[model samples]
Target chain A: MKILLSQSLMAYLSEPWPWYVSGGLIAIIMVLLLFSGKNFGVSATMRAGCSALGAGKINDFFHFDWKKAQGWNLLFIVGALIGGWIASTLLNDPEPLALGSRTAEHIKSLGLSLPKESKEIASGFLPAEFSKPEFVFSFKGILLMVLGGFFVGFGTRYAGGCTSGHAISGLSDLQPASLIAVIGFFIGGIAMTYFLLPLFYKQILFPLINELQNSFPK
Target chain B: MTKAEVISWYRIQEMFLFENFHMYGVIGTAVFLGLISVQLIKRFKAKDIDGNEIKFEPKVFSIPRYLFGGTIFGLGWAMTGACPGPMYTLVGHGYWSMLIVIAAALFGTFVYGIIRKKLPH
Candidate 1:
């Protein structure tokens, strides 16, 4: 069983053709968005939904009146769902990215409590605890997530756009603010990973890692 | 590059501010974008139909709002390991399941809209 799994995983990882295919598809989508006089931004799409539900028409950010413009964002969601599933299932690369040992240790220090099974100390990430449904719905988890969502929404509004608008659209358009926002994003991401996070986990993440390592195929 | 060209170049630099770096990129991007957006509202002089620009003037976002919002976004980002835009970029690359985040994001937006009138803006 182990051998079979490894072979399949290796095969998935070696599939280089998908990268090109996916890249091409994204370019096509970009062209379509450009032609429509609307930029593609997932964050903005949510704002659109908010407007639809009654956020008061303070701006036309959500007013993509064209019939085709209406549900195009939904297509983006569908596309992403399909993309992630394929990458994980077929590619067999489902594990979180290991940023580096030092980074990982820093994340651990943030009270994230790394899972013991995590191989290196600098793995730059706190293995996902909220990926599962149970964890996601938990009181503490859910509160953090919802509060997080509200923050993102409010932040995007104040920032005049979401990560995408700034990263892709704004960057492409040569917007200075977008440039700064992208920089701040990286800084903020690093600080959270290294500093503020430890205050919450309190060593819980490490034990989970230990449990995971023991269950490894080896 | 001309002055506008220089300015545009500068903007590009600012836009990509921390994308290549670690951690601070997310919040840096957010705040930078917000400030730029405020400037955009002013520079473009974009107005409402009455010939008066619909002021992009955000009265008072407050520090708490900024902190809370940054923390929330950072958490979601850390959990998913992909910010909102990249999530879509991932999809375009064929990560189909990212729709889950997209759906959740949309749902969150809907909920926010319903309660927007009551919230601090």
Candidate 2:
């Protein structure tokens, strides 16, 4: 019975739903959050984590009553992680993620590798070349992860939100700051996609791929 | 998990790479719905679940502030190919290297905490 139930569930999970199904669900979540008098974002969890660990003694930003201010955000992240695990492992479709032709072409043009395409490497919705440990622990990987991570971390806090915070909730709230932030995000994204991204591939990742590649994401 | 993979792919990958219109379709739907919902709620003066009057706090707009911040975030996001939310989901997806990004993001947040007062809000 359990196996039968899971099989049916898997069938539903694996099929692609229309964009509105997900989009409508996302909007409903935002509406729910608004109705609860809470704003949503992912980066806020860092502050809560720090405060929860009593980092407030060291830093005022972390010195809030995190249990009151940002406790729910932490739970959100925890739930996301566990829920992701369940979906990735148990409820997952055995077939690899299907990439659109354009994206596949773009990945190849940029010299990026996808693990889903490679039978030996196992990954879920991540670029094998940039995300796998073999690349992560090396010179190129270190630069990419460290520099990229620093930008994400500092930038989100400085701006008062990340993608979800600014783009989803902030915009939904109809704030002007969010509009500017959203524009900036697009400009930066475009610059990276067209300009910095090519340079990174040509100067760093491509050459690094030639020189290394030892382990997998397992 | 489905949300993370499907949504992140469209949001970060497709949008950044200019791959297709699907990302736009999805995001636009959400934003449109959200805009309408917010308007209706305000028009009705809907109270929150706690029965407090729902409010939208006015943000101080400075051209340089959010622009710089968001651009920096975008660069980081493009390089990492995952934003703050999906970084955790990627970890659950078994991309353990995302831990490095997670640690660095926390450190960055801590750094921001240290200098929060120095920067203009």
Evaluated against the true structure, the overall lDDT of model 1 is 0.46
Model 2, residue A12: what's the lDDT?
Answer: 79
> lDDT of each model, Cα atoms only?
0.46, 0.75
lDDT of 1 by residue, A147-181 (tens): 54444555555444555565545654556665555
Interface DockQ of each model: 0.11, 0.62
TM-score of each model, paired residue for residue: 0.53, 0.87
Chain A TM-score relative to the true structure, per candidate: 0.62, 0.82
Error of 1 at B120 (Å): 11
User: iRMS for all predictions?
Assistant: 11.0, 2.1
Total backbone collisions, model 1: 67
Write the residue-wise lDDT of candidate 2 on A1-218 in tens digits: 99999888878776554577767777887788788888768888877776776779998878888888777778778777786687667666565656777767766777666546544323346666645567678786787788888888888888888877888778877889988888888887788877887788888777776666644342
Clashing pairs for predicted structure model 2, backbone only: none
Poorest 10 consecutive residues by lDDT, candidate 2 chain A: A115-124
Q: What is the lDDT of residue A74 in candidate 2?
A: 80
